[model samples]
Target: MLYKNSICFISFFFLFFFMLINFFFMMFFIMENMVLFLEWEIISFNSMNIVMSILLDWMSLVFMMFVFLISSSVIYYSKSYMLNELNLSRFIILVLLFVFSMILLIISPNMISIFLGWDGLGLVSYCLIIYYQNIKSYNAGMLTALSNRIGDVMILMLISWMMNYGSWNYIFYMEFMKNDYSMKFIGVLVILAAMTKSAQIPFSSWLPAAMAAPTPVSALVHSSTLVTAGIYLLIRFNNLLIDMLALKLLLLLSGLTMFMAGICANYEYDLKKIIALSTLSQLGLMMSILSMGFGDLAFFHLLTHAMFKALLFMCAGMIIHMMNDIQDIRLMGGLSINIPLTSLCLNFSNLSLCGIPFLSGFYSKDVILEMVSMSSLNIMMYYLYYISTGLTVFYTMRLFMYLMISDFNLLSVYNLYDEDYIMIKSMLLLLFMSLISGSFLSWMIFSYPYMIFLSLNMKLMVVYISLLGGMLGLLVSLMNVYSMNKFLMSYNLSFFLTFMWFMPNLSTYVLNYNFLIYGQNLVKFLDMGWGEIYKSQGLFNILKYYSIIYSLYQLNNFKIYLFSFILWMMILLLMLIL
Candidate 1:
């Protein structure tokens, strides 16, 4: 029975792998030179006259390579991690399905095809997220699926609108959008779709909630695969978004998301949630940079973030596996001796996460900072770049210290290295790749910005300051200055603690608290002011009162008969037109 099972598994695995490989290459051959025709040959669609197939030669290749590498590693990692487990074959099938969908998403000929591929992956991910079949996993998966679907619904509507206007049929839609004034609306809707997939701002809560998934799922979902879909959409539609005011709104949203997530990561106790929120924060920063019109920088960051973040999560998984699935930092410590290799990889990844000089993260992240300075887009971006860079280092180092150095020994009750060598090998491979991939890709993308330019040079002063700021954060982490013990001891007097109790009041007085936190006061002021302006006397209030009075007056049946007749006539006219 065992031999038969082994043979069957191997046969099925090879079959699925080769089948997908063949399908993708086949699609590539057919569409190799197929220009992404928007509309049949209708009206004439011309955006830049630059061929998308050729433009995709480099960027699409980079993303496809990432998809394959990560997916392959995930399968390999799961092999050892799930050994002796039931439903193994089903898991492998899902793995192939995921790879197939993701690759299709990358190579898709147009927005519609890309979306089809994207939605397919979203479906696969929902199943994967709830794979454990526990209630919490189900709940988290449901929330994640619903959130992603909301984005999808917006995207579908936008696509339908674009198709109607012939944008999908660009030469197809030119005649249509030319008269519609709806491109702007569709563009904004598309960005909203991307934002949710990318986990920006208000839609971001689901991402961290998704940590309930198995560690591998968390690693795959957060580290530049699922979330990166949003960035990909924006990049693909760069020309359209360039002139939209929605781009600026997206930029501001990204900045706020990056800042808030970094702060929350600093407060999280679960090891997975720390990395989860960090992924959310980093994606936001990348989106902000891209929104500022630097797709190259965004792509570069996407690359490096994938490498280091994956390495970190896989290492976290190893740690959790050893501790019998304990994920809380409060229950971990002193694993440096027990899991030396894991510790080393974790430290290096953390350095990259902190954007230490010369690490992969440094090259990609600092380049965005440079762009912020160099671009004539917005002066306000400078503050966002500076402060978020600092927070990135702070929270990253804090998690590192808490997990590897701080004197928590609750994990002593459990073993801390039960993982198989296969898992460790996969992680080490990622770390090794991450150590060099960023710099090498940096050179490639930078030299070819029009084709592949990935800028390496940032403002020297800003780079220096950001590096120094990260170091300061590292120092604070090393000193254990912000340990939970300290916070608990002074819980009442703690600013964060007090603010937690009076959230409503703090929100109300945020304007008065200006200048305390870098952007908190400003955000508070805006929210409060906007709240009072809208809630107290905004147009909606007037409309609400009007609605009540109108309903009561309608009860009198004065104009009821005439209104009903007119409404019926209008409905009949609309129906006839349809």
Candidate 2:
């Protein structure tokens, strides 16, 4: 009862207070040196020393404010969402642990501390994903864990690599050895680790799969905790690690990731999976921009995206709850009438996500697209960026129609109502942030705004792509089984896109097939060779059976003598002939 009522409020209030303090610090740092540091020595040895460090800067402070703000709101939201569960306390504790680990990751400059936080985020995320204890959640959790475990290994290797520099504080030496072979080696390790955490390309399957988690966790995971961890790491190490070679590769991979995730979201039917894929798409955009050495732009987009994405997930969760946990978009329509406030919030967040002008997303994404246009990059990347941007609108509008514009499609009673005040209150907080964060961040992050020069055609390219995408979305959403069922007509293409380019299939079944077969063979061989023969009970039973056979033969000596005489005569004849 206390947990259901008070724990969230306690955490929420405290985190809100801390957010204010951090925001002030962020402003101060921006006006001053833009970065500061603190260190606390934990231990020292003859040649080795351990120190814990905190990185306090405008960037870190801003990230901390967002993390604290989003997590607090998420915790508050979860209290109402998970009210009926028996293990509510456990869920709340895990959420707090997740936040603590994220804070560790956000502030730490020391490699050891960062590793602790990095590994902690992965471990806690696995626990949260399987919080429901179902087979689906279990499978999702395993996929999430093993995929992230690769990043943990890479971080460990990086920690050892840094040992040659004689300090566990990676922040200290990133600039000093930026061009050395060992440093580039470190960059490779960092990029690999960040890729797994951020769900780029091959690791992307886990991001969507992780939707098996509770929706509040989704709000946190997608917003600031799990997926953004990688982007944040890359932002911190951008100048230190990523070179031209790494940049080109990252740009290519992240651009594909953006395109792939956007297409999947458009084809997706599950409400939460669509949102999850949307987060993946946005992450890719951030990574792509960062790869071009625009770390500030990436971070700007990251903060703004976190605001709206959290609200988006919350609104989706509210609707899903009203629908009795049904997440299929096909089952939902005309919700805007029944749940006006919730629907309004949902669409606004969705619009922000589509980068509608003046919204938080618009300020960041417009700059990113313009930056891409002006930069000296190849035609493929330019095409990919715009095409993916349009796809974002396509999915967003498709989802909008399915959620709000279509006729009512519910089979059960329509319980969709904007009555959950507790949930609404937290969502309103994020809605306010998503509305203003981008504009505020744009003015604050830079002393002078970015002046991008482009021809008129290129300047309007985003508007053009968005309009085309909106038309595609409208067409896709309006098509019915009686008119045009794309799923059935082009089932193969739909299946391929919806399956996230068969990443899950390749990652799970195809990749593990030989290993699973070998394991099965090993089990069979062990049981047949050693286990079958060496068992005490089996050995005793065999001896007893043979002794019984011998006793029976002795009792039947006359019959045995007749058989033996015939055998002996044949043998003697053969010997004589020889």
Candidate 3:
């Protein structure tokens, strides 16, 4: 146990040291406006090259630095959270593997090598999700794995498609591929791949289901590394997808995802799942921005969102740990009175997530909203973005009211304490980052500033929506006197929002039920009917009959032998006459 704790400490130090070094490297690159690329061929065949490569620009460097930072913090927090568990070493190793995979993904310029990272992430995440060894964890792990496997399959197909160009390095060819009409199919496939990873629309179910994992895993995977992978991929390929009709479709779907996740999060009662849905909502926001050609803006939000969202999950972890793993928000209230520091962290992270002014989220989210307003979009698209933003504020406020402001709901016999300095210390690092990362990254990434020339109403659009959402959120929380009865009366509407419009059912049962039933029937028919008679049973019966007849003939049945000999002679004579 002491050795395991030492390993955690060493790992955290190593990651922190690397993060500092990368920070300096990022600053140097920014000063020189330089991009560093290095590659070595692993296989060469018929002018097609497969290589391991790295692309070090401001984007990859900064993103990798943040990944390491968050990973280090999560590891530190887990030392206390999982201290009593027997598999401490195993947990640390899985997390380290996850971080390594994410770094490989961040650096890779070649699609083939990217596959190594992408599939590594999927596999490692599954291991982490099912670490608890329970039915819920196992099911969630399967869903997470299978859903991501779709993206992996698409990526494999993409590698085959890119082989047409005789190179697997997408970075080198993105500009050329931009105008090539024949490569539009590749762009579509790429969008589908991103959709599955980022949890956009139909792929959104897995993200919330994955809340069954430990909270630290949720903080690392869902908040920063795993879910952001899709957005990162799209950001890298944004130039190629800029003009494709697929991006327009992506835009619509992403917008809908934002709205849908926001609505679902408001109705969710599970603390971790609520935060998981919030992560999903933010992913949609990033995807929507990327689809509109604001790759840098999307990337900006991705980084900032990572900081606050990870912190949010960590805070949620602390709460769930204190509450003895009780996750239902309905069973939790007035936690601020007991764990003030945690409540502070939770509220700050939530506010940042809601785009509160001067925080990390506001720096990126506000700009993204302004950019959305300035873009040439349809009215529905415009409304969805703003409405989704407002809903974000609403759900966050609702969560805040439920967890921090309401009356204490737990039994008096239970003791609550917040003396876990290790967890608190880990959270403080991200709490600091969540406060400043947005402005810091925004200044670093954007060379030429975005110009937003909009009318007065449009200029304050985000503010207006935020205010309205805040008001409604407060009203909803405090006005629950008769609302529960009314909600019970309107069961269908309540059920729809609460279950994310049956998205879990859609993905789990509706999607697989028919195919599963058909497969079962096919198996039965093959085993009991055609396959049985034609292959095993029929062949065995024929062999047995021949053996029995031969035995009878060998048993000195002279009449049978004579009859057989006469039949053969008659057959031979007829053949000769013909």
Q: Pick the TM-score winner.
A: 2
Looking at model 1, residue 508 earns an lDDT score of 27
Give per-residue CA lDDT, model 3, range 475-561, as digits (tens).
Answer: 888987247638655877777877877888997778778988999998789977899999999999999999988899898888989
Q: Tens digit of lDDT per residue, candidate 1, span 1-578?
A: 36435643574456446545644653463446333323233343565442232123556766776666666566667666666658777766776776677776666556676677779878988888888899988977877787788788987887787655443533334333532468778778879999888878767767877888777767777775788888887887676777578899999989887877777676677889888878977998889988888887898899888988888888888888777777888778777877889898899998898777888998887677765766676656677767777777777766766777777577335555634778887777788878987887776666545332334444465556666666765676666556844745575555553222333233223533454474776656666678657765587789998999778756868677688789999999999999
Candidate 1 local lDDT, residue 326 = 78
lDDT of 1 at 380: 66
TM-score of 1: 0.73
What C-alpha lDDT do the candidate models reach, one value each? 0.72, 0.90, 0.90
lDDT of 1 at 122: 83
Model 3 spans with C-alpha error above 4 angstroms: 41-50, 481-489, 519-578
Greater TM-score among 1 and 2 belongs to 2
How far residue 44's Cα lies from its native spot in candidate 3, in Å, is 7.9
Give all TM-scores, in the order shown.
Answer: 0.73, 0.91, 0.89
State the displacement of the C-alpha of residue 241, model 1, in Å, after optimal TM-score superposition. 0.6
Runs of candidate 2 with Cα error greater than 4 angstroms are 45-48, 481-490, 528-533, 536-578
